[model samples]
Target: MEFWTGLYLMSFLNMACCLPKSSYTVYLNKLSFSTAQSHCLPGSFLANIPKEEEMAEILKTIWDKNDKTATSFWIGLQKNKGDCYRKDLPLKGFYWTVDSSTQSDVKLWETEPSNTCLELRCGLLSVKYGETAATCNGFVETTCRQEHPFICKRNATVTCRRPDILGTHDIIDYSNDKDTCYVHCASGANFTLKCSKDLVWTVLGNQNMDTSQLCLECNKGYRRDASGYCVDVNECEESKPCTHRCLNTDGSYKCACSDNDMDDCDGSKPPTTDLTRNDYSNVNRGKSLLTQPTSLPDDVRTNETDVHIEESVGDVSNIIVPVIIALLIFIVLLVIVAAIVKGCIRRRTTKLSRRKAEAVALNGSNSMEKVNEKEET
Candidate 1:
């Protein structure tokens, strides 16, 4: 079934789970550097000062509780005494035995030692003073000399003896402090089991309790469903958790840049600039159309009708202005044609009249010439 349809049903479902804190062990034994190194074997090493403030604070507490004398136990630091041909300095050779690391950032020192001194080599921890150099063969007096006691730091260990169910593969986690509460054991291909704080091994999908338990959300990017199973939550549908688009993964969601065309990420209604004309296609116009009353009184109807009439009149004027222009152009063409025709007729008439007058004058001159000839005879 779709998860969204069941969202209302499981609206009160618990989402948070509890986790256990990491465990640490401290051993207080008086021994030489080599003896102390062997003492913290199999599981732990000499206490290596941690970088975290909380861990440092814990070590300080342990130190405060046990510190009664000037010389305390040796920590992870051991003296690096090399032969005469050794090119490396004494401080350079010094390293942590825990992981063979030479990283030394946070150092508690009573008085900083000068590398010029060859005898003082191994690291020693004093209750009131802090970390300082001491001789390996016990030479320096009143400070850190002779064989002294030391502290060893080890991580609390947890082991799963057997699988909660038969034919199931077990996944173990002893690394994280927060992940100490539950262990993941897979049944079949998809389903998993979680061991809760109550020491009860409950299979996922078997609903006997309502309270949240660690590893219930077994997968990292998934959420627990009503069936008490871990499932991916489609964050894009309900919460709209992304700036642009939300992509759901195993137990987490990722955001992406929005597509082009419009800058709005939520895919909301597009913007409108001209509001004078009613466009019912948009949300704003639809709201305006819905909010107004359907029926109107006689006077209101009259006013609306008058407004429509005015609009119609304006439309008519817009159409009439172009038609009038076309008609004026046609009339001017006709007048120009008529004037050209009249001018041609007037020129033809004048030419015909001139030709007739010339013919009559020629005929009268011929008759006069005939009379003159008869008188001469």
Candidate 2:
């Protein structure tokens, strides 16, 4: 029992040992690369590229300081799941990012392990439990509590220069572990910060905070979290006016209603519209009787019709027999006139031609007789 108790105490001590009290105040705990962007220099190649040798060295240093040799630390080298790219040369840095320098070497691609290619960065596996190789993505069941060696870095201290206490919610607290603080923020609580090095969290916006942008209020609909994030207030039920559709946005809610209406005003009906042949779809703007009344267009045709009924009556008023008789008489008179005119013209022209012929014949006979007398004498 005594031996077990001693072991428990030692385990507790180790859990709290050598860990930085405040990461925000120190530089060693600063974040450079995560499961992603583990390799490559600051802003080089890409935010990706995991450095293997350096990561291994960090773990080695950690183990040395702890006076205990660990089997493995989570490394950022994932398997080469990129098909034929796996066979490409110079196996270094992060095999996942395909670092700019190595991309040219990729000639053929082979099918990658089903789960290998998708990760932004690979996890390092412990050499003791899993193989040093075996495609280390920390797959197959490994967690962070394994006491593997880890690397640590300190970040430059941030000081808030301007002090403002808009409210209790305006303050952001500084912590040794910004990652932990961020996690707290993700859980729906914001950090309350202060300016002094002692790191008391009660201070409002400290006069020393340099970045005013990062120091802000949780917008109207959102509330702050311990991690520094503004979480959305769950307003799916009432805050949204769009009863038809409620969409959850970053920090607020939105209501969306469909404009198309088929027939009945049933909100629950879907995939079908309610509309009549002559009725327009929208309930607010259906066919107005004032514009298109149920009456036929002919009922309201032009009302200025003033046809002369008296003229039609007068045209039928003539005595039938007398009118026909008058027409017959007029026709006979026209025939008689035409015949007389023709006869007169013919008689006149005949008389004139006959006289001309007779005169010529008589003159010829007289001249002949005179010629005979003169010859006999």
User: Best-fitting candidate, measured by TM-score?
Assistant: 1
Candidate 1 at 124: error in angstroms? Answer: 1.5
List candidate 1 segments past 4 Å from native.
Answer: 1-24, 50-55, 63-71, 83-93, 114-120, 129-145, 155-377
Tell me the TM-score of model 1: 0.30
* Alpha-carbon runs more than 4 Å astray in model 2: 1-166, 169-216, 231-234, 237-241, 250-252, 258-377
Q: Please list all clashing residue pairs in model 1, or write none if there are none.
A: 73-149, 73-150, 221-250, 221-251, 221-252, 222-251
The total number of steric clashes, by the backbone 3 Å criterion, in model 1 comes to: 6
Please name the candidate that would achieve the greatest lDDT relative to the true structure: 1
lDDT string for model 1 (1-377, tens) is: 67876885565443212223333344455676777677766445666654544335545555555544534557776544441212243224455667767555454455444344345456665544345322122212122245676666543343323334333344554454322333333422333444333334444556363323432335555665544456786766767776555566555566544433333322232222212223212323345534663543333434445556767889999999999999999999999999999999999989866755665577787755665565468
What RMSD does model 2 have? 21.0
Tens digits of per-residue lDDT for model 2 on 1-377? 99999999999899767443322111122232342233222222211123444334444444344332344343333343342324335433234333334422322122232333443433333332222322222222122223233232222233324344333334333455332221122223444444343322332344343323334556777765444445677776545444355556566655444444322222332223223322331322434533554442332211111123433455677667678999999999999999999999999989866765665577786755665565468
